[model samples]
Target: MKALEPIDRTQRAQVVALTGKYIEQASRIFLRHFVMLPVFFDLSGRLAGMYKVHGRTRCIRYNPWLFARYYEENLAVTVPHEVSHYLTDTIHGRRGIRPHGKEWREIMALFGADDQVIADFDLSGIPGRSYQTEDYRCACRSHRLTHIRHNRIRRGWRYYCKSCNTELRR
Candidate 1:
């Protein structure tokens, strides 16, 4: 395993402090409606934010850099949007419903947030492939190669078209 560079302790402390402030503010806003509200700031997941079902927990899964990258105006709205998910969960009993639904949207509006929370990160289309795969059909003309075996084949083994005599990449 590769050794990692040490993190700046002061910067880590600052990030923790800022996250604590957000969690505290969110807790206060939701406490009136909820019997208990637990807010957590997670750094590991790709999810920007999620409300855990039945737990009444609102989680903001964003890197510490987001605090500096996004404006306070946007954070103010996003923080509440995630909180509203918790509120909706509490009200509706966390049943079969879309993650973001009509009930959640109304709650977000009532919380004095924007019509939509501007994300600090991308929630765009799915990630694209870096390289063409042998699993996929070859792009070369005259000879189209179809993958045969599911198992890995040995290198230097011929993958040529017997009909066209075109060599295919392994």
Candidate 2:
């Protein structure tokens, strides 16, 4: 790996824990000669699938629930796909340019991860339960709503809108 700064021991341990669990599941289908590196998994709005940051960490922003739903059956390949990035980065040092170039893709294939399958997934498209409400509209006006549960509403008082008298959609 490039001479990048090391991550905190605790953070590295957490990554190992998650990586080990994924590896245990993946080893049955792929090679098991790799180790997890410490990296930050920044869950932001601008991510496309998983990526490596600072040459040490793998960052993926998929929703835990949605990811489990999609990859629960083949979790190992997905994990290896991400690890392949780490491996490729280390081998090439800082000279690595293309994110999913030929070398990285080859590494993924070696680890039994299908590049096509990983490419088919639009990681950003996975639906996550919104803790923030989507925009709502009534008449000519539109506004955002709270994400409170339906059970939290107190009877008939819930239907009336604070902006206008428009009865809101549930």
Worst ten-residue run, lDDT, model 2?
Answer: 40-49
Tens digits of lDDT, candidate 2, 63-97? 23333334433244545666666666656654755
Clashes of 2: 1
TM-score of each: 0.47, 0.43
Task: Give lDDT: candidate 2, residue 54.
Answer: 43
Candidate 2: RMSD over Cα atoms? 13.5
The residue-by-residue lDDT of candidate 1 on 5-40, one tens digit each, is 222456445444554554455557657434434444
The lDDT for every candidate, in the order shown, is 0.50, 0.51
Tell me each candidate's RMSD, in Å, in order. Answer: 9.1, 13.5
Using lDDT as the measure, which candidate wins?
A: 2
Q: Which ten residues in a row have the lowest lDDT in candidate 1?
A: 123-132
